[model samples]
Target: MTYKLHKLLPAGAAVVAFATMMTNAAADQIVKIGHVGPLTGGSAHLGKDNENGARLAIEEINAKGLTINGQKVTLQLDAQDDAADPRTATQVAQKLVDDKVVAVVGHLNSGASIPASKIYSDAGIVQISPSSTNPAYTRQGFKTTYRVVATDAQQGPALADYAAKGLNVKSVAIVDDSTAYGQGLANEFEKTAKSLGLKVLSHDATNDKAVDFRAILTKIKGENPDAIMYGGMDATGGPFAKQAKQLGLRAKVLAGDGVCTESLAQLAGAAADNVVCSQAGMALEKMAGGAAFSAKYQKRFGHPIEFDAPFTYDAVYIVVDAMKRANSTDAAKILAQIPGTNYNGVIGTTAFDAKGDLQHGVISLYNYKAGKKTLLDVVKM
Candidate 1:
């Protein structure tokens, strides 16, 4: 609910850690972990939050002086900027592979992560994504790919159920950015919403780069749907929301994890208030390391933490801990240890199922209230 930041120690410490990683590789050692995300693009803010969360975990684990396999090892986090672009993500991942990281923490968006994941898997590296919810990632049968957050298949339906039951909306319009994550979620929502007896008015699509939504909004308005659901990240989401409102569609807007970031609120302005969004993890207001991480993040970055930060933070720990538990950083060993993991994460108990899915995970609905996306409620499955 609140945030505070401690004064940052000089960047010299990280420089020293990087030095240690370059020269030393023995006992009293540092375990280098690489995390990649769109650190400089339209979704850059979300990527920074994801990286910060991972850094916070590394700092905490190092503070604990965690002893694993009878070695006093420290955690060292190496972050890469993927720019939210698929090709750039692959390049960042290749750099991480060359570094020979004990494990990899991310490729935040599905579009970027999917291709980068192929690189990691081919390199025999274990990768855990906090935000890449596209089902195709796990279905690929690559033992190295795992997801910390629940899949879009789960998130889409939870929002669909809310739109049908709580909002009592009969006609719903669907829109998506056509990215792997966006299209996957939009498809799931459309299927589930229609199965729930709601009328599917108009199904439209957009790209992350396209700005003008007047035509789609006009069509949706003509359809007179009770609500509009968007399947995209905040970058496109904020504009879509603002445009929808500006075009006088007025139908309640709903979206999945992609649109749950704070930047969306800035884009939609007052229009953001009426939009209902669903996210894959617990709200920063209520989670295992929620408050502490938020405070630390604000101190370091001078801003509030985004919604997906906890999962990213926990994912870092999960990869490191699993590697340590496996006794060897062999990709197969680390990958095998992920299933049925029960580590206490910043988001609470972290566990994965046989299908490489989080077991009994939770999803939450957020309403932008008082200039914030407060946790309206949670839906778990």
Candidate 2:
């Protein structure tokens, strides 16, 4: 070695040697999984919850030492903030595609998911939406789209049935956040509500970013409906409920999975007691691995689970499972494998129907009492 140093290597030899060493250090094949949601707005908490789910799964997969075709692979998450806006969602979607991510896990709201789906389809990337419940998301005939939860087609009817038959309500008023998730669910619920012999008093529109719902609430209050159905996320839903209580409204607040988050209690405060919500899946206590998953999630994220974390967690596994079946990290191969997804995940047996929707989706009804979500019933569809 002393003699070799005396001979003096070429001027660029040291640089070349350093580059080779760095290359060897990063020899593991990296598979990028993109996660999109509103990480910095009113629904930021819910978006972060979804991101954490994907994060936990990626960490677990990497720790377990994933290998495909004898090549060690490291799972990497490329989380993007869409701010629950469709235009921003498409921008994030295009960025992920340009970055060559193998799969995508989000766009939590149906409004974001539906428009962003086209970008993923054009790029031949697999997109598994965890919380978007609008039926139109999967009905677009894009082979690249899939969802882990039930669609609004099922969720809306279940909520309407509960209101009409379970609560025995005679008349109801509806308010939507004007996003696809809100508007679609409201329309479906309105359809089923009318068919079930309940009088529909009024259906009003509210933007997702509107914090002051006093005007709409006052109008609905005057209608004297037995219940008020809201089709929006917990951000708006919680405030709507709280304001309704403040306005001395006697009508109970009802909503779909958009408002079924655990944070609803905190946001709505005392008004949470009057809020009832529905989720597009079974309650956590009734899920196959819900207890264990929730425990692990809390330990890792330092927070309680939100509504669709389990579904997003399972979505990560589904993407990895498709990769495993294909024995490759190619996006097209993974996309081809998604249609046959029959994974037994934390949410139960997740299988896609002809339209890439969950085949055996279940809807669970929940009510907030003492600032906690209590399960009422699980309706299998």
Candidate 3:
């Protein structure tokens, strides 16, 4: 009987120890954050850049360990691809809401972000866009919608001011891809150009998917405007500039942040030199921690940034910052804390106003020289 009792005691202790291990494992919680972007379309490179930024942040956060409400938590990134389409974006938004993500960071395009904002607002999820810059996005009165980049209202005027003052241009022609972002920026530019006393030669509209701009370029060539402003992404803007150069159109190409990317030189070739563009934030090299972030990013991703990575990277930290301040993983609590955020991150000091827009926005202007993007000026608005 003593021998049997001794054998059973060891088994009983092992079972008790196993139960304790299970309790400890169950104490750790999983917190998911959704990130949506176009991962399969023309803008896939930029979308992937945004996703990678968020992913890197999540990995780092998890490695360092996070505790919320006294419960150990592991961060998970739930990334979705919207293909840069408005309809797809809404679907992706719904999926994230259904997944019950604590927060979301994405829908990079203004067309995608604007429509997706309503769904997120309804779900009470905080949606932070790192690249969407259309003014109407924040003006829709959705308290949940926020962006790290400046709006077209500021970006367009900055580019127009540079064209009129720095380029010394007398007349300009305008072209837009007819999407929400492109047309909105072109409209703002037209308004400011007229205000600056620059002659408006003509304004033309094209679809975002269009590859050939020869017809528009030919028309503008006849008008012989001093410069041409293109409102579209680099996928189309590069081809537009290339076709214009091929047609012997000498007008300098002016574009917004969508066209300002590290890949532009490869797309536009020699014609890249004729392009002047505006990015809706501080230049990467000028960001407070830009150099260090760039090196770390390159080492991790094996490639340079495509323009929006830094913004998105800072966005993840801002979200985590709100989480820390709220002291809880509840989405509502995090959302409530975001409006009062005054985080000094990689992109510089970030604070949002009543409309969820950055309180102090900066636009960086660049001109391509010898097939490379060169900084021209930085304007604070």
Candidate 4:
């Protein structure tokens, strides 16, 4: 009976040890990261691309395991749809703050990012935009706001330079969708175009939701400008180019990063050949890890990237890098470390200026040939 009791005691001790281990494993802390973008509107494809990039990064980080402040951590992605609307963006921003997200990876559009930044700023959480390009976004004096892509200020000049020097256009007509992003980019482009000694024939405004551009195009057709600059997303820019072509308007169509996308060819069809656009970042194929990322992205999402995925992917990793540097998962601690970040990731080295804009921004100019987007030049700013 004594021998049996000793044997049972050892077994019970082992069970107790196993239970303690299980409890420790179950106690792993969860860290939630918010990702916001237009998941149901005209920019849904681009938004999903950004979300998938962050999702892939979060999945990879979790697979490898994360330990901060001596605590094992499991990362979570809290993705929200802003629908590309400014008001919706603010509502979602407050939602993320209330949900206690440690960090946020987006608000893909400049219009969305600008208003949503205040919400994040008030909550003391970090908000990093993967694609927002309006200069006003970073200029609002919010330390919590950051963006991975170049601003419209840089992208606008690059496009205008291409028009003046590359295309050698003498006169240009400009049209904006009137949203913060669209109008801001057009204003910048117009400023630069004028500085370059190009005659500005006309500058027009149209709402982003407008479908028919014939009225605007017809008005511009009479001007017979050498080029037409469109400040809007691919959803509108694609159709605008198509209509211009149908009207027999032979002017080259110039656009900013909003209209530069993989789906632009599909949207604009044969008219895509007549469009020249600028992207706020390096071409995907030209990025340091672009080929590998493209292969992995294709395998994971079963589609080609539209635009901005690589930037979002890099943004997620940058947030994790901050966490590791601070040695803590606390939002405030992570935020403090972001200003000093110099991360080299899938989008090359990323560092921010005083306003949280990319220190070294690259603009890639592209045109479509045979229904494929082709890179024309890369301008470093």
Candidate 5:
């Protein structure tokens, strides 16, 4: 009986010690990262692209067993749909804050991002927009707001310069969707085009959700301009270009990053060939990590990376990098570390200026040929 008692005592202690070790390891933190975009609207394709980027980053981080401050950490993505509506964006922002997300990587459109920035600022959360290009987003004095792409102030002039020098456009007509993004970009383009001696024939406004642009196009046709700039997404820009073709207007179509997507050819059909657009970053073919990232993105998402997926992908890595530098997952600590980010990413080196905008932003011009977006030139600003 004494021999049996001694053997059982050792075995029980061994089991207790193993269980305690597991308990300690299980205490590792779960860091929540929020992503927002228009998941159920005309822009859903772009939204999904952004979400896929964030998801890929989260999966990679968790699979590698991320460690912060000596604690095994897991990254969780809490994705939300803002419907591309400003009001919806604020509601979604509040939900993410309530859910305790340490950082955010979205609100793809400036119209939605501007309002949501306030909510993130109030909650002391970090927001790094992948595609929002309005200068107002980061110019609002919110240290919590940042973006990976160039603003309209940069992209607008780049496009105008391309049209003036590359396309040699003499007179131009401008049309905007009236959203914050469309109008802001158009305003900037108009200013630059006028400065470059391009005649400003007419400026028109259309709704973001509008289908028929015939009335506006008819008015623009009367102007007989060499180029017509449409400030909107591919959804509208595609049809606008197609309708312009059907109307027998000889003027070429010009647009900003909103209209620059792989799907533009599919949406605009043959008219896409006559369209020229500008993106707020380097072309995917020119990105240092573009080929590998594109292959992985396709294998995982079963689709190609759209407009700003690379930017969002890099945004996730930037946030994680901030966490590593701060040695903490607390939202406040992560926020504090974002401004100091200097990580080299797939998009390029991502470091923010004092206003939380990417300091070394690039603008790439593109044209479509044989149903593909062809890169023209990348202008570093």
Candidate 6:
């Protein structure tokens, strides 16, 4: 996967510039942060969004003389790409550990975040993810792991409920990308759909690079389900939606945050029209502080990174707020400071639940119509 780098630096410079800043900041009074995500591999777009979001925020904070303990402080980020793989994610975490960052914001996909989280937690680092939505990640009892997005339990089941109860669907088939985010969400939807007495007739798995899903759709069509639910992101889900339509599967397709991106509409084209996708957090252009953040991102990156870049922008600021409140850069101090954070983030008013899950009771249901995503409803979590 190719990365869409921010315009703050020359192209192909995200890792070098960010790592150098993290290293050089020791000479200056800086609140150093590390952002880990897939800068390459199939999930590169998400990683780039995560990395750029932090860089943009930290740059602004430093320029504005943001301070801690009455002393103006510079903010820096050590951006590392995990390649969206577990082993690679662990390596990224180690890179941050080597840099000794004050806090972290990253690992876009839930799979990478889960294993990489143990590294941060054991080392007494505060990690706040901007977009991971798996429930098990938070349920693992890690005090330092936090996320701004609602969990798959919240997003996946709600989508399933809507397909079964709200949309008046009787039966559904499901597909996953064999990723933690994908499989985990598929499981939640399957369980919930069963609880609601909706028939879950078929379930299958694919991967990020899969370009052909006609076989899966064909198998699903055999079940004659009213809808087909997918547990994956736009990289794969977008193509899946398109393939399903091309295969003559007319059943509505429903998906979770993993696939709720503006890019999906383009990937699926006319086939995306009427396909439902749900996700946590308000869209980048719809949330508070959206226009400003969007303009800033576009100005810095020459293009938009992803739909939820502002949430990452907010994630870095949230940690910065904690650093100021704690009056120290100690990881423990910042970790403890996270819970009561009612930061006026670009996404919305963000506060953490007892489990370190962002009280983002804000989940939106969206449908692609006429090449645009139409917001159907906002279900407050």
Please report the candidate that would top TM-score against the real structure: 3
Model 3 C-alpha lDDT per residue in residues 37-84, reported as the tens digit of each score = 999978999999999999988888899999987889999999999999
Clashing pairs in 6: 7-300, 233-258, 361-381
With candidate 5 superimposed using the best TM-score fit, by how many Å does residue 174's alpha carbon deviate from the native?
Answer: 0.4
Clash pairs for candidate 5: none
What's the lDDT for candidate 1?
A: 0.83
Candidate 3: where is the Cα deviation over 4 Å?
1-27
Q: What lDDT is reached at residue 335 by model 5? A: 97
RMSD, each candidate, Å? 10.7, 2.7, 2.5, 3.5, 3.2, 10.8
What is the C-alpha lDDT profile of model 5 across 1-381, one tens digit per residue?
A: 999999899899999999999998878688899999999989999999999999998998898889998899989999999999999999999999999999999899999999999999999999999999999999898989999999999999999999999999999999999999999999999999999999999999998998899999998888999999999998899999999999999999999999999999998999999999999988889999999999999999888888788888999999999999999999999999999999998998999999999899999999999889999999999
lDDT of 1 by residue, 111-218 (tens): 988889889889888888989988888888777888888888888889999999999999999999988888999998999999999999878889977788888898
TM-score of 2: 0.94
lDDT of 3 at 296: 86
Superposed by TM-score, candidate 4 places the C-alpha of residue 340 at a distance from the truth, in angstroms, of 0.7
Clashing pairs in 4: none
Clash counts for the predictions, in order: 2, 0, 0, 0, 0, 3
Task: Indicate the residue-level lDDT of 169 in model 6.
Answer: 93
lDDT against the true structure, per candidate, is: 0.83, 0.93, 0.94, 0.94, 0.94, 0.83
CA deviation > 4 Å runs, candidate 1: 1-28, 329-332
> After TM-score superposition, what is the CA distance of residue 221 in candidate 2 from its true location, in Å?
2.2
> How much is the lDDT of residue 301 in candidate 3?
96
Error of 1 at 197 (Å): 0.8
